[model samples]
Target: MTESLHIVCPHCHTTNRVRADQLASDPSCGSCKQALFTGHPAALDEAAFDKHISRSQIPVLVDFWAPWCGPCRQMAPAYEQACAQLEPRVRLVKVDTEAVPNLGARYAIRSIPTLALFKNGREVARQAGAMGAADIVRWVQAHSA
Candidate 1:
C-alpha cells in the first residue's frame, strides 16, 4: 500500500487522506471539494490551529504574529511567498497573536514574529525574526522532517 498523508483542509478544516507520492498532483478535499493546498497560508485561530498541528501528517510552519507589530507586518509578504513555495510538503499557517493571546502563551511565543515548525504534534524548530522568502523556505526545508 502507498503511504498516505493526513492533510487538514484550509477551506473547510476537514481532514483528508492523500497519497504521499500523489501530493504533487494536487488533491482536493472529499468533504469541501476544495484544493488541499491553495498556495496561501491558512489563517487559523486557536481551535483550528490545534486541529491542524495535532492531526496533520505534514510539517506545519506557523507564523505567530500580532497585527500591531511592525516587523510582523513587514514579514507578511515574504511569509506568503514561502507558503506558496513550501506547500504540499509543508502546511504554512498564520496565527494572529493579538487575537489569540492564549495560543501565543501556550506556545511560549515571546516575540512578535516567531516562526515555529511542528511535525507530529510537536514543535521541532523555531526562529524569532523577520526573514525573506528564500530564508523562510530554506529554514523550513532544513528543519522539517
Candidate 2:
C-alpha cells in the first residue's frame, strides 16, 4: 500500500489525507476545495498553530516572529521563497509573536525571528535569527525527519 500523510489545509484549517506520491500533483483540500499548498507560508494564529502542529503528519516549519523586529521584516521575503521551495513536503507557517504571545511563550521563543521544525507532533529542530532563502531551505531540509 502507498503511504499517506495528513496535511492540514492552510485556508480552512481542515486536515486532509494525501498519498505520499501525489504531493507534487497540487492536491486540493477535500473540505474547503482550496489548493493544499499555496507556495506561501500560512499565517497562523494560536488556535490554528496548535491544530497544524499537533495534527500534521508531514513536517511543519514555523517562523516565530514579531512585526516590529527589523530582522523579522527583512526575512519575510526570504521566508516566502523558502515556503515556495519547501511546501507540499513541509508546511511552512508564520506566527506573529506580538499577536499571539502565548504561542511564543509556549514554544519558549526568546528571539524575534526563530525557525522551528516540527515533526510527528513535536519540535525536531530550531534555529534563531534571520537567514537567506537558500540557507532557510537547506536548514529545513537538513533537519526535517
Candidate 3:
C-alpha cells in the first residue's frame, strides 16, 4: 500500500489525502481544486490556524508577526523564500498578530516575528528573531530533524 499524508488546503482549508511520494508533484485540493502548495506562506486566521496546526500530518511552521513591526516586515522576503524551499516537507504559515490577537495570546506570543514549529498538534521548537532565508531553512531543518 502506498503511504499517504493529510495536507490541509491552503486556499480552502480542506483536508486532502495525498500520496507521500507525490507531494513534490504539485498536488491539488479535492474540494476546491486549488493547488495544495503554492510555494508561499499561507495567511491564516485563528480558526484556520487551529485547523492546519492540529490536522496537518506534516509539520507546520508559523510566523507570528504584525503589520507595524519593522523586524517582521524586514524578514518577510526571507520567510517567503524559505516557504518556497520548505514546502511539501513542511507547511509554512503567517499569522498577523494585529488581526488575530487571540491566537497570539493563546500561543503566549510575547514578540513579533516569532517562528514556531508544530508537530503532532504541539509546538516542538520556537525562535523569536528575524533571520535570513538560509538561516531560516537551516534552523527549521535542524529542529525538524
Candidate 4:
C-alpha cells in the first residue's frame, strides 16, 4: 500500500487519509465529502487558523486581506490560482484582518494581502502586498518542499 498522509479538511477540519503520491489529484474528505483543495483560499477565523496552523503537517500559506483593500481584491484570483497550482503540498488560507484584528496584530500584518508561510504553527516567512500568480507560486515553492 502507498503511504497515506493525514490531511485536515479546510472546511470541516476533519482529518482524512490520502495517498502521499496522489496529493495533486482531487482528494475529498471522507466524512465531509469536500474537496481538499479547491483552488480557492480557505476562509479561516482565529480559532480555525490556530487549529490548522498548529496541526497541519504540510506547510500552510495564509493571505491576510481585507474586503475594502483594492490590492487584495485584485490579487484574489492570482492567490486562488497559486492555490490550485500548489495543491496538496501547500495549503492556502485566508484571514480577514478587518474581522480578526487579533490575528492581524499577532502576525504584525501592516499591509493587506500579506502572505505568511507557516510550518508547525511558527511563521517561516511573510510577504506584503499583491503578487502575480507566477510570483506567488515561486514564493510557495521557495519556502515549501
lDDT, candidate 4, 1-145, per-residue tens: 8888777799898777788888878899898898988878799899888888888878899999999999999999999899888877888999999999999999889888899999877899899989999999998888875
Superposed Cα deviation of residue 18, candidate 3 (Å): 0.5
Q: In candidate 2, what are the lDDT values of residues 1-145, reduced to their tens digit? A: 9999999999999999999999999999999999999999999998899999999999999999998999999999999999999988999999999999999999899887999999988999999999999999999999984
* lDDT, residue 19, model 4: 89
Q: What's the TM-score of every candidate structure?
A: 0.97, 0.98, 0.98, 0.91
Query: What is the RMSD, in Å, between candidate 2 and the native fold over all Cα?
Result: 0.7
Q: lDDT by residue for model 3 over 32-82, one digit each (tens)?
A: 999999999999998899999989999999999999999999999999999
State each model's CA lDDT, in order: 0.94, 0.95, 0.96, 0.89
Alpha-carbon RMSD, candidate 4: 1.5
By TM-score rank, best first, the candidates go 3, 2, 1, 4
**Given candidate 4, what's the lDDT at residue 13?**
85
Worst 10 residues of 3 by lDDT: 46-55
- Per candidate, the number of residue pairs that clash is 0, 0, 0, 0
Global local distance difference test of model 2: 0.95
The 10-residue segment of model 4 with minimum total lDDT is 1-10
Q: Which candidate is the best by TM-score?
A: 3
Which residue runs of candidate 3 sit more than 4 Å off their true CA positions? none
When superposed on Cα atoms, how far off is each prediction in RMSD?
A: 0.8, 0.7, 0.6, 1.5
| Ten residues in sequence with the least summed lDDT for candidate 2 | 136-145
Ordered by lDDT, highest first, the candidates read 3, 2, 1, 4
Worst 10 residues of 1 by lDDT: 136-145
